[model samples]
Target: MYKLICIDLDGTLLDTRQRVSTKNREAIRKALDQGIEVAIVSGRPNCFTIRIMNQISGRMGHITFNGAYYRIANKTRQFPIPKEAVMKVAKLAQKYHVRTYFKNKNLSLCTKSDPGILDYDQFKSQTPLKDQMDMLYNVDVVDVLSNQDINILKIFAWDENLENVRKMREELKEIEGINLYLYDENFEMSSEDTSKGKAIQNVCADLGIQLDEVVCIGDNYNDLSMFEVAGLSVAMENAPRKIKEMVDKVTLTNDESGVAYAIENFVLKENE
Candidate 1:
């Protein structure tokens, strides 16, 4: 039986509205009742992840920052990007006017000046977060980065110019100690050892559960790594056709409660 369910939040558990569906929550609670563990794994920061967890009513750990950080109970293990690497990407983003956002320990941050429209959900203007400051810290981004105590979890630059992205890839290719990847138009940077697969492996090892005892569901390029390590992988119908080809099964779209569909038909039914 599967002991762990590692699920991606955006485009997997949460619909385009960026809210967890009731059906999805029910499935998750069912799994929890069945003695399985469910973890919210996302490319978002802990602040947003905690908000999402609060919206649901089940016990779950979090693998946020695209697997660069793992949190269970109140304790956490994080592989924060080095200060130098964080600044490098931040400076590059500023130079290219890429409209970037930074995830630090307590609050997320963005340029107080006009950084232009960002594509990430949390950076959007109408996010459901109650406290605007808690959702993001608008400040002099460069000055904020210079502060030595800042524990950065992730750096994201929205993809507006393909040419700029290409240029960045070529420029940062040799940069040591950082891992960068594209999810949609966004350029996401984190620590070299951070990834969903690696994080899940680490969590599995810690929980004394083998990789084969895990089931993962996601719908993006970042989710590809988790698919590699999961015993069974479910791709959302909204996922690209290329991603669907990579997983064991494809469920309904997020709007259609794909997570719930995957769990009810695959996880719950099989156990029964």
Candidate 2:
């Protein structure tokens, strides 16, 4: 029987509008009522991750910075990338004028581009206003990263040119001991060993659960790691063909409350 559920926030649980649908909210509650432990794992920083987790109730866990950090409620842990790897990306970002941001368990740092404007319009589009305010308060100056003394977990770069983003990714791939993930809007770099998969493994060990007793659901390439580890991997209908192909089942799209459908059907109903 599946005892744990790992869900990705941006694409799997949050709809295109970037808000959790009521259907999904109710379904998640049902799973918790059924004694299923729900965990939110994402490439997002802890600030955002914690906000999302707050919205859910009961038997929860979280993995942030793409698995560089793990949190099970009040407890938290960090899995840091090598200092050399982080420094290499920082220097490269500075040299190339790439918009870069660094994340640690306590603070998040970002390069200063427009002193007058820090929040990019596109990146801030769907973010909730309060969360944006929280970020503005917590984001520190980029100079802190130059020292490399801080426990850097992940670095992300953004570009308007999609092709350039992919190109940079190809280049970053040559960097030893680092992992790079390219999304539609940005590139995330981290330790080669840190990923949602590794985080899930760590969480399972903590909870005394086995890999086959877990279910995972996500909607992007980043979510592929947890997909690799889950016993019942679920891909949203909106997910790409490749993601669907890798999972055991395909549910409705996020806007269609795919998470809700998966839990109520495959989880709650099946277990019943």
TM-score of each: 0.82, 0.83
Candidate 2 segments whose C-alpha is farther than 4 A from its true place: 73-75, 114-148, 160-171, 183-185
lDDT at 212, model 2 = 93
Query: Model 1: what TM-score?
Result: 0.82
lDDT of 1 by residue, 19-102 (tens): 888999888899888988888898776666767776775377889888888875434678888888877776776676655677
Off by over 4 Å in 1: 73-75, 90-98, 111-147, 159-169, 183-186
Collision count for each candidate, in order: 0, 0
Lowest lDDT 10-mer window, candidate 1? 124-133
How far residue 143's Cα lies from its native spot in candidate 1, in Å, is: 4.7
lDDT of 2 at 220: 82
